[model samples]
Target: MADRSGNNKKKVNQGATLKKVFERLGKYRIFLIFSILLATVSVALTLYIPKLTGHAVDFIVSRGNVDFPGVLRVMVQIGICTLVTALAQWLMNVCNNKMTYQIVRDIRNEAFHKIEILPLKYIDGHAYGEVVSRVIADVDQFSDGLLMGFTQLFTGVATILGTFCFMLSVNVKITVVVVLITPLSFFVANFIAKRTFSMFKIQSETRGEQTGLIDEMIGNQKVVQVFGRGEDVTERFDEINERLNRASLRATFFSSITNPSTRFINSLVYTGVGITGAFAVVRGSLTVGQLSSFLSYANQYTKPFNEISGVVTEFQNAIACAQRVFELIEEEPQIPEPEQAVVLKDIDGNVKIEDVSFSYVPEQKLIEDFNLDVKPGQKIAIVGPTGCGKTTLINLLMRFYDVTGGQIKVENIDIREVTRKSLRAGYGMVLQDTWLKTGTIRENITMGRPDATEEEIIEAAKASHIHSYISRLPKGYDTWITEDGGGLSQGQKQLLCIARVMLCRPPMLILDEATSSIDTRTELKIQQAFAKLMEGRTTFIVAHRLSTIREADVILVMKDGKVIEQGNHESLLEQGGFYRHLYESQFAH
Candidate 1:
């Protein structure tokens, strides 16, 4: 029963591997046809070489003379054939390389697009390094295999069949002797390929994990140093490095055995063929020319077998890589855009959430039976402890993830009824983790609406209280920023984010701990900008600082995914409830 099960699994894996390879190649059918034709030409050229040598031998023995003219004619014919085959081979290589590059480009683009549209849950579940590894290492393997292994596999098969046909025509008895050893050689080659493939798969997976670990270590280098865990980190990394070394060694060792073993088998076949041909000659069944031709054919046949073994090994590695790449491409995202969805238009930003419930995992509910209503132009504040689902609320509002239950409406329309792009276009956001690409300050601020005029950009920056600072720089608004805006201070980065949001000028605005990273003085300046920006826009503020929310028209204090207290700031204080307790505790310090 166990053996049956293992056989079934092996068959399934083989089918899947083949399916993936064909699917990848389907886009390059034209190139594949050209490749096959070139391979056929190359094989024909190789087989003709042995026949030409046979003719030369026959001419020398039968005429008892060199037959220079006949020999020269054959040489010229072979040369022409060789030239045509070489040109065809070059064309085949060019097409194959083109196909490989095009396919890799498409796969990388698709992967990046999928990453951009994937739901937050999907991203949260994966490591950044692993995701990056899929884009780089795995895709590169597919490219290498497509360009190198695929061409070799087809060409080797053609050469093998062509050589076999020529050998059989020369002498069937010697052909039979050579064919007898093929099965054993095949079995040994397959066994080595299987072992090598398993090791390569392990190597790829471990390499991805190690990449993830290294990315995490670099991202949190400060944490490592602060906690004095550098030595511990080093030890952990060493363990991963050791595993990688072992996997690489195992893979290389198995792969190294394939070529030598194949060559040895070919050598044995050559010896057997030589002995059998000599016996046939002595038995009066073959002439000296026939014996010489048989030896040449035998040698030619072994060349293909040797080439085929190497090609097969490479194909196995490529299949392993294809398996990983297909796994990623086949994954269905947690959230997908609806077909033919309606696009929202002219939204006034009156937002309402009714009995909304959500959870990253099904069992651990983060928000349940939560409700809220914000009239147009109203400022709403949400207060909660960490993990109380404040950001989750914003995520649902932005449709990053749909609500697990209940309904969220924007401008009197169910958010799900509108297209995702339209739904997001109605709102502007300033997140705690502000990101800035490498570009001029003007470019970053005008990213969302590039067509915005220079005057409009400056206006938005002024509204966010960042224009003065930018104007003072040597390059002014054109000052270049490094990736993640490294030259800017944290407060400055946040201000730039605000400036960007202001340029968008959406009807609804969300500030998620926007001032949490700034000092008191900078926070005051930001708060002033926030006051001006919030005017006439429906705004949602999420903050731990009570002072930030004290003036809100409506305040909702939440705990354990429930809205435990709701009222205006003064009314909530008078009630001396959860909101009042939070205010007292937070401000009393």
Candidate 2:
């Protein structure tokens, strides 16, 4: 009963996936209809050519008594059929190519759009390489399968039907022979397809795992080498690669069995038709030319069974791949903003976190009943040890993940009641992990405000103390960088990110260890720039280095997901509690 239930569920899922694929295809229904019509025309002409050949054969009744004119006229008809079939087949292929690629394009676009809106929790929980595989590798595999189905499956089925009709017109016995043996081919293909689907699905998953491992290792090669983990990484990779190899081999073995197995069955059908047709001719019930036509029809009728078997095998893999792509496209996105969500404008940045509770996992308590309130334009610094919810607080402020409990209000309005875009747009953030796209330095700086004037761009760069470095580059502001900001030091990358936020000068600022990478001298200069940037604007500075937040209006010390103490730097030092212990530990004599 359990096995039966599982099978039923699998069938339902497959049916739903097929429905999605067809719905995408239905958008190009006109092209699909045209392709089918052309396939029919092509197969009809192709099937007719065999009969014309048989007629040309019959016209040679005797060697010298042959009606040459009759044979020539039949040959002319055969030529016309061949030419028309080729033309129709060509046009059908063109239509199929256009429709198949368009559907793939739509699926890719939806998947990418879904990724963009996916909640931070979902992205954080999944490997980057696995998601990338769905978009790139799995989509490409589906494309190949769809193309094969369009190019071969349509015409193959049409030829089978046309040949059966043509054969029935010539002789009934041969048609019966071909029809009787065709099911064996289907039985073999169906049995293999059932097994191969699960195996191919396994193959795709393992391939994703392998891709994720490679991406993880390559992205952090420096860390891996520093930690002397090359051998361990290679061992892990080999294990995954072996699993992928095993799964691929099993799937290919089953799928490969389909084509030849069906061909063997088809060969038997052909032999049966030839043997039965010969006896009919001996019985004076059929002419040689008619028997010849029936034999050609028999071969044609069984040929599609072989071709369709291969198509089924490939289509199974495609379905598995499409399932992954669709899964990504259907992934739950970020919680939707309220229908009539307020759009924040000219924000005064008073913020209150009221009785907030949250956790990455539901069962584990991370932040519980957390609360804070700040006046507008207060430079509040958050200092904490690692994983004590400093970053989680930042995430909540950015609405990357919604709190599980309680409310966070900005300017006396619930943050959830405002559009996320508007809420996020009011703040400038520079994290320790700097990101720069592959573009000119000017482009990276002006990303938040693209219409910033050249003078403004230069000013921001100068303020962040990066203008001198940029001026030294060969192309200055126009110098192109790689995606990972290649050829740039960690300090330089951080400065570029700082310049980015400095240019925006948003109503609020979030600096999550923003100056952690730069030397102390550069840090002091950037801090001065940040001081100017923070003037009359609310700022939340998260830092492990206690020295930097000394000038902040308020300092909130946190530990174990709760604030332990809050005061100005001098008062917090006077308390001589956990806050003083942390400060003393860092700046101890």
Best by TM-score: 2
lDDT of 1 by residue, 541-586 (tens): 9988889888899888888888998989999999988888888897
Question: In candidate 1, which residue ranges exceed 4 Å CA deviation?
Answer: 1-7, 61-64, 287-289, 338-340
Best candidate, lDDT: 2
Error at 455, model 1, angstroms: 1.1
Tens digits of per-residue lDDT, candidate 2, 1-589, equal: 9999988987787789899999999899999999999999999999998899888888888868898999899988988888998999899999999999999999999999999999998899989999999999999999999999988899998998899889888887778878888889889999988878788889989998888898999889999999999999999999999999999999999899898998899899989988998999999998899988888888888888888889888988999999999999999899888799999997998999999999998888889889999888999999988988999999999999899999999888898999998999999999989999999888999999999999999999999999999999999999999768999999999999999998999999999999999999999999899999999999999999999999999998888899989999999989889989998999888
Which pairs clash inside model 2?
Answer: none
Provide the clashing-pair count of each candidate structure. 0, 0
Determine which window of 10 residues in candidate 1 has minimal summed lDDT: 56-65
